[model samples]
Target: RRNDPINDALWDVYIARSTDGGTTFSANVQLNDTSFVTPSNGRLGEYLGLAVDSSNAYVAFTSSISDLPLGDVYFDEIANSDIPEPGSAILIACGVLALLRRRRRK
Candidate 1:
């Protein structure tokens, strides 16, 4: 997102994401805002990039002002699966132990 001033100056910019495919978005937090000091009169903007791999996804963006020519860039990565809940590791360990015992019995 971006806000442009009347004179074409950029003021501020923000970026956000949702791990659940946009069902719910994270806060519209400011990733970069050149006009942070004087927000009301300044402008803002953002450029977003997205990529995915078999196990992970990534999002990136940059925000800046017209005069600055360079903006802060940000990136985030998400795993394909939600983080396992508590006790999940114990269950996995038990399952592996059971398999090992079965193989030893044979």
Candidate 2:
């Protein structure tokens, strides 16, 4: 993510991947900008969230610095064979199930 208040309060996000590990990175691609927020702060940029599932990665970030009421979410999926270990998968599945069960009781 990159942002500059001097550049007309522009903020940009990019999704990158490297199959060869951290040795290389793909070109940056703009995701969203201040237009996502009405009357943008002209300094819209901060706070980022990133996550990944079995087949995809996701990113979300805030577009306003003051009186933030909403945020933009983005996602991308990559194809690869590097699967997680069975134990890790099981743990993640159990965690999700637990969360669901808890929500059901509410």
Candidate 3:
């Protein structure tokens, strides 16, 4: 969940990928080019994640890009191999299922 840091009125969705076991992550990449805005009252309502196959990653979310007051559904996808890297990755979410196992210094 992102609130377009650049534009207060325009909301955006971004995702970051980690290739080195979460030690580092790629810079946040936007899912789609569509311009999205929070609901009039600023509630996203509901959204869900799709799946990541061997070659591609997919995501489904709700947005106000097409629908104004009520909002609508949308999707974004990227190839697995294209995922880049970041200086460091330390991502934590509320319902995170798993995290990279950090190595203990000897």
Q: Which candidate, 2 or 3, would have the higher TM-score against the true structure?
A: 3
- Models ranked on TM-score: 3, 2, 1
**Clashing pairs in model 2, backbone N/Cα/C closer than 3 A:** none
Which numbered prediction scores highest in TM-score against the true structure? 3
- lDDT tens readout by residue for model 2, 6-99: 5443445454444443354454444453434323443333345545554654555555434556544444333323322210111111001111
Candidate 3 residue lDDT tens string, 20-75? 66766777666657657666766653454545555666667677777456877777
lDDT of each: 0.36, 0.37, 0.56
The C-alpha TM-scores of every prediction are: 0.31, 0.44, 0.61
Kindly list the per-residue Cα lDDT of model 1 for residues 1-93, writing each as its tens digit.
135446444434333334443354445444343442222424322244545545554545443434454545557564535323110111011
In model 2, the Cα lDDT at residue 73 comes to 45
Q: Which candidate should be chosen as best, given lDDT against the real structure?
A: 3
lDDT of 1: 0.36
* TM-score, prediction 2: 0.44
Order the candidates by lDDT, highest first.
Answer: 3, 2, 1
**Collision count for each candidate, in order:** 9, 0, 1
Tell me the spans in candidate 2 whose CA falls farther than 4 Å from its real position.
Answer: 1-8, 33-46, 65-106
